[model samples]
Target: MRELKYLNKYLFKYKWHFLLGTIFVIISNIFQIIPAMLVRDAINYVVDNLNIYQSLGQSATQQKFFTVVAFGIMVFAGLIVLMAFLRGVFLYFVRQTLIVMSRLIEYDLKNEIFEHYQSLPLSFYRRNNTGDLMNRISEDVSRVRMYLGPAIMYGLTLITLFMMLIPFMFHKSATLSWYALSPMPFLALSIFYVNNIVERRSEKIQEHQSRLSTFVQEAFSGIRVLKSFNREAQSMEKFDRELDDYKKQSLKLTKIQSMFYPVIMALIGVSTILTVYAGSMEVINGNLKLGVIAEFIMYVNILTWPVTSLGWTSSLVQRAEASQKRINEFLKTKTNIVSEKDLVREINGKVEFKNVTFIYPDSGIKALKDISFTIAPGESLAIIGTTGSGKSTVSSLVSRLYDTRGGEVLIDDLPIADYNLTSLRKQIGYVPQDVFLFSDTVANNIAFGTVDSDQSKIEQAAKDADVYHNIMEFAAGFETRVGERGITLSGGQKQRVSIARAIVREPKILILDDALSAVDTKTENNILNSMKRIMRGRTTIIISHRVSSAKLANKIIVLVDGSIVEQGTHESLIGREGVYKDLYEKQVLQEAEEKTS
Candidate 1:
C-alpha cells in the first residue's frame, strides 16, 4: 500500500468529512453482519426440535407452527431490507466525501505546482516540455485522485468485512476455521508479485503517454508551417511511430492485468472447495452440528468478495505508489532562481550589468561573459548582435528570467537581487518575440493584468499599439475570441496585441525584444511611431537587428561574442565603420539592389 504522507496537509483540511464517512461505513458494516448471525440463530431454532412451534422454545401443545415460521420470514426480511438501506447510505457518503476530497487535492496540488513553476527560472522550461508539464498537472493529478476516491472505500470495505468475519468463523468451528484460513499467506504473497509487475508496466505506459502528448502538441501548434512546407505525410509518419510505441505499452499493461484474474480465481477456487468439502465430511461423521455447517458456508460467501478484491486492490495500490513517487519527484525539484529576504520594490529603471557572466544551465560555454554597461532612465538604447551573441540573455536579465553566475544586475544602483520579483517585473513592459495570447477578447487580452483598466483605457492602449482599427473590423469587434495562441489573428496583429498589453501596464521601462519582427516596414514604422509618442518619460530598450529600429534609439549598444563592440548613435557608429556599420551598409545595399531588380 502507498504511504500518503505527503497528502497529510490536505487530509487534515478535510478531516471532518472523512470522519463522518468513516462513521457511516462502520455502522453499515456492523448492521450488515447482523443478517448472517440471525440466519444462524434461526437455523439453530429449527434444529432444537422436530416440532416447529416447540423448536424455538414455544408451548408444546400450541398450533402456532405456521405463525412462527411466518414471523421468522418477516424478521429475516426486515434484516435484509435494513442491511440494504444502510449499505446504500454508507456507499453514497463514502463516494461523496472521497470525490470532494480528491477534487480539493487536485486543485491545490496543480495550483501549487504552477506557482512553483512560475518561481523557477526560464532554464526549467527550456529543459522540460510544456505538454509534459500539462500532463503532469492534469492526468497525473487525476491518477492520484483515483486512489484517494473509489479505491479508498473499496479498501475500507475489505478491512471491515475481515474484522467481522474472523470472530464469527472461530465460534462456528475452531478447527475448520483454522483450516479455511491456512492458504491466506500464499494468496497474499502471490498478490504482491502481481502488483510488482503491474506497477512496472504502468510506469512504462505513463512514459509513452507523455511522449505522445508532446508530439501532438508540437505538431498541432506548428500545423501552419507543416502544411505550408508540404510536410503533412512526414508529420503523420512521425506521429504514428510515437503512437505505435504508446499502443505497445498499453497492450503490455493489459497483458499483466489479464494474468491477475486467473491466479486469483484459482486460489479462491481451492479455498472454497476445501471449505465445503471439509464441512460436509464433519457433518457426515457426526462431529459437527448441521446448523454450524450451514453457518460456516454462509460466512465463506462473505469472505469470497474480499478475497477476489485483494487481487484488484493489489494492482491499484501498486499503480498509486508509482504515481506517488513521480509526484514527489516533481515537488522536490528546486527552482534555479532564488529570491532574497531583503528584496524591495523601489527600482527607477536605471539598469546596470557589472562584469556579468552567464551560461545556459546545461552548457559549458558561457553565453554572456564579462559584460558591463549602464543605462539611465528616459534613455532609449538598442542592442544589435548576431544570433546567439547573448542579445536575448542581456534582455532577459532585466526581467530576472535568468540569474547571472558572476557579478550582478542592478536597478537604480542596487543589485537586482535586492528587489522583489513581482515589483521589479511590474516596472518593466516586455513584448516577447514569440507572441502568446489566450483564446479571449481583444479588450481582455490588452487589459490582461491591469486592475483598473476600463473600456477607454483598453482602446487607448490598442490605438497606441497601431491595432485599434484592425480589432474594430472583426465580426465581434473587441469581443471576438483570439483562438488558441491568437491563431485566429494574423502574425502582425498578434504582435501588436502583445504590445498593447505592455502599453496598458504603464511601465517605467519598455522592452521590445524583436517584437516588431513579423510586420512589414510600413506597419513596423507606424507601431514604432505610436510607441515613441507615448514613451517620452520612460526608459525604452529596443533589441533589434533592423537598423531602422536601432537608429530610432538615442543610444545604440552593439554586442558581438558576448561583449559590447561599440556604443553610440547610428550616425556616430556609421562614422566609426565597425561591425554595426558594416551590417547596416549590407542591409541598405540589399534593399537598394532589390528595388533595382
Candidate 2:
C-alpha cells in the first residue's frame, strides 16, 4: 500500500476518467438495488391480494381481478428487466473510462522507464541485467495496471453496493439486516490474513520470474555457444529446476487464492441461512411480512459477488504494491552524468586528457592511471598497447562516455563537462572495439548515425571503409538485413559497416578503437588510405595493437599496464629500441612469415 502511493500522480493525471468511472459505478449500483426493491413490492402485492382472489372465485368479478393482477405482475417484470439493462449499460461505461485510463497510464509509465533507462550512465547498465530492466517496464507495469483497472473497479462496486443495500435493508427490517450482515466482520478478518500471505508470495514470485526471464534471454542469445559446446542437456536441467521452483511458488499462491472463494461463499451461505431462519421466526410471530424477508434475501444475494471479490481485489493491490516498489527503485536512481550546460558548442576537436585517472565503477578496476595526452585539431594520434593496457579507455574519455575520476577531460580547451552532452557526443564519431549493429538493412545501419543521410552518402562511406564490394556481393546488396547484431555479415564486414556508420556522421573527432582488426592487411591498407584523406582536417585517434596501423599516424604512444611508456613520431619510435620498436619488428616478421607460408 505504501509503494502504491507512487501512482498518485498518475491517478491525479487521469482524475477526470476516475471521476466519471466512479459516477458510473454509483449509477450502476443504483440500478442494481432498484430491481430488488421492485421484486419486494411485487411479492408483497401478490401475497396481499391472494385472499381477495380466493374470495372472488368463479365469477366475472374474479376474472377482472385476475386480469388486473396479471397486468401488474407484467409491469413489475418489465421494470426489473429495465433496471438490469441500465446497470449493464453503466458497467460498460465504467470499463471504458477506468480500464482505458489504466491502459493510458501503463503507456506513459513504460515510456518514462524507457527514457530513464536511456539517460542512465553505462555504469548503471553494468550494474543491472537486461532481463530485470525489461521486466520492470513490462511485467511490473502490467501488474500496476491491474490494480488501477479491475481492482479499483470492483472495489468501488463493492463499496457502492454496500452503501446502497445496507441502509435499505436496515430501514426495512433491522433484525433481518443484522442477521444477514453478521458474517461481514469475520470475512474482513479472513481477507486480512490472506492478504499478508499473498503479498509475501507475490514478491517472491516476481523475483523468481525475473530470474527465469533472464535465464531464458541469456540462453536464447547464446544458443550458438550452447549448441557448440553440447551443453543442451545441462541447460535443459537448469531450466527445469527454475520452472519447478516457479511452479511451486505459483501453486502456493494459487492454493491460498483457491481457499478465498469457498470461505466467502461459506460466509455468504451463513448470512443467507441466518436471514431465512430469523425472518421465518419474525413472520410466525406476526412481526414481519414474507415480502420483507424475500427483499432481505435479494439484498444479501446482491452483495454476495462483491464480498467474494474482496479477496481478489486485495490480492491485486498487494501484487501492485510489490511491483511498484521495484519500479520506484529504478526511477529514483539519479544518473551521475548530466549536462551542466545547455548551449551547444561547435567542436574543433582538440581533445586533451589532463592527468586523468578512471576506475571502472562496477569492477573497481583502475583502467587509466595518471594518463595525459593531447590530439591537436586535424592531427592523428595512434595509441598502441597490449591487451587490457588502457588504449580504449583513452577513446572513451575523449567522447565523454565517462567522466574522469581524478582529473579533467577537455575539448576545445574547455572542460568536456561544460559542453552540452548531446552536442559533444554528436560531433564525435566513436567506433568501439566490440561493434554492435541493429537488425536492419546494411544501408540503414550505415546511415544510422545521420538520420537524413542519403543513399549516396551511405554507399560512399561503405566504399571508404573497404566494405562496398563485399556488400555488393550479397543478394540484396545494401538493402540486405544484417540480422541480430549484424549476425548475417562476417566479422570484418560488421566492423567495416560500423566504421561506415561513424563516417556517415562526418564527425569532427573520429576515434576508431580497433575498428579494422577483423579486416585483412590489404583491406586495412586501402581503408587507411581512404582514412588519410578523411583525416586531413579532422582529429583522429586510432587505437590499435598493430604497428602497420600506428605507422600511418602523425604521432604514436605506447601503453603498458595502464600507463603511457613512450611517445614519439612513428619513425622516431621505430628507430628507438623500445616497446614500440619491438612490436613493429614482431609484426613485420609475422607478415613476412605469413607471405612465405
Candidate 3:
C-alpha cells in the first residue's frame, strides 16, 4: 500500500478508462455464467420428458416427446454459443482499455523519471552507479506496469465472480455449496504464506540483477584498459563470480515462485473431490435433484478458476510492490544544488572566490580551504600547481559545479548561488583535463556547445583550435564519425576538438583545465597564439602544469597544498626563486635531454 502511493497520480489521471474497463469485466463474467445454467436446464428437460415412453406405450406420444426435447436442447445450445461469443467480445474491450492504459502510463512514467534524472545534481550521480539506475527505470517500471494491467484486471474479475457466484451456489443447494467451499479458507492462508516469501525473494533478485548489470557496464567501458594490461583472465574470473551470484539468486526466487502452482492446484483439487462426493450422496438420498447437483458442480467449477489464479495475481502484486519501493526511493532524492529566488540572468565575466572552502561529498575530505582569488573582466589568470593541489577544484567552483562549504563565490558582484544554474553556466565555457567527445560527426561534436550553430562558425572555431587541417585529411573530413569517446581520433585530436567545442560557445568566461597537455610544444604554442586574439575581451583562467602555458597569462598563481604560495608574473616568480621557478627549470632540462637523445 505504501509503494502504491507513488502510482496514485497516474491511476487517477486515467481513472475513466479503468472504470469503463472494469464495467466490461463485470458484464463479461455475467455472460460467462449463463451457459452453465443453460446446461442444467437442458439436462432436466431431457430426463423428465423421456418418461413419456414408460407411461404411455404409444409410439406417437414418444415421437412428440423426443421432438420437444430435441428442440429445447438446440435452443439452449444456441443461447450458450451466443453468450460465449458476447463474453469474448466484452473481454476484448476490457483488455484494450486497461492494458493499453498501462502502456500509456508506462510511457509517461519513463519520461518523468528520465527528466528527474536530468535535473538531479552531479553529486547524486557520483554516489549511484549507471547500471542500477538503468535497471530501476527499465525493469522495475515494466514490473509496475504489469501490476497495473493484468494483475488489477484479473483481480477485479475474481472479486466480481466471487460475489456473484456465492448466492447463486446457495440457491442451488446450501448444503452442497458449503461442502464445495470447505477448502477455500486453507487456500487463502496458503496464498498469504507464499506471497510473503515471494516478496522478500523478489527484492533480493532485483538487487542482484542491478549489481550484475553494473559489473557488465563497467567492464565493457574499461575493456581497452583491461586488454592493455593483459588482465583478461582476471576480468573474466570476476565476471564469472558475478554471474554465479546472479544465477543463484534467480534460482532461489524461481524455486519459491514454482511452489505457487502445485499448492493452489492441490487445494482446488480437494474442493472438487468434496463437491462430487457430497453431491453424489445428496442425489442418492433424494435430498437433491440431479439437475441441481449438476448446477452445483458448475458453480464450484466457476469458483475453481478464480481461486487457482490467486497465486499468479498475488505474485504480480508482490513483485510490483517491491519494484515500486525502489523507484520511489530514487525519485525522493533531494538535489544538493538549487537556484535561489533572486536569479541573475547574466554575468559580466568578473569572477571571485572569497575565502571559499569545499569538501567532496564522497570522501568527506576538504579539497580546498580558505581559497580566495579574483579575475577581472577581460583579464587572463593562470593557475599552476602540482597534482592534488586543488587546481581543478578551483575551476569547478568557478562554474558552481559543487556548492562551496564556507565562503562566497561571486560572479559580477553577486553571489554565485544567487544566479540561476542554467543562466550562470551558459556564460562560462569549461574544458576539463579529461576531454570527452561524443560518438558523432566532427561538425556535430564541435557544435555541441552551441545548438543550431552555422557551419561557418563551426569551421572558424575548428580553425581557432588549430585542428582544421588535420580534420580535412580524414576521408569524410568534418563529416567523419568519431567513435565512442572519440576513440577514432588521436589524443591530441580529441583535445583540440574538445577545445573547439568550448570555443564555439563564445563564452564570456573560458576555463582551460590542462586542455593542451596532449599536444606537442609547437602546436601548443600555435594554440596559445590563436587564443591571445580570442581572449582579448574574455576572462580566461588557464590551469596547467606546463611553464610555457602558464607564462602566457597576464598574472600567475602558484598553488601548493590548496593554498596560493606565490602570486606574480612569470619573470617576477622566477626572480623570487620560488616553486614556479623550480618547475620551469625542470621542464627546460627535460626538453633539452629529449632533444639530445
What do the candidate models score in CA lDDT, each in turn?
A: 0.79, 0.90, 0.87
lDDT of 1 by residue, 129-201 (tens): 7766776777767777777765666677778778777877777677778767766656767766877787778
Give a tens-digit lDDT track for model 2, residues 1-597: 899998899999999999999999999999988888889899988999999999997999999999999999999999999999999999999999999999999999999999999888888999998878988999899999999999999999999888877877888888988998888778777876777787788789978887898899899999999999999999999999999999999999998878777877788888889999999999999988887778888888888778767876888887889889999999999888877876597989898888999999999989989988888999999999999999988987787777889988988898888888888888889888999999999999999877889999999999988899999999999999999999888999999999999988999999999988998888889999999888889999999999888877889999998898999999998788999999988999999998899
Residues 26-55, model 3: lDDT tens digits: 999999888888887887777777676467
TM-score of each: 0.89, 0.93, 0.88
**Counting only residues 3 or more apart in sequence or on different chains, how many pairs clash (N, Cα, C under 3 Å) in candidate 3?**
0
Best by TM-score: 2
Candidate 2: segments with Cα more than 4 A from true spot: 191-219, 233-257
Per-candidate clash tally: 0, 0, 0
In candidate 1, residue 185 scores what lDDT? 59
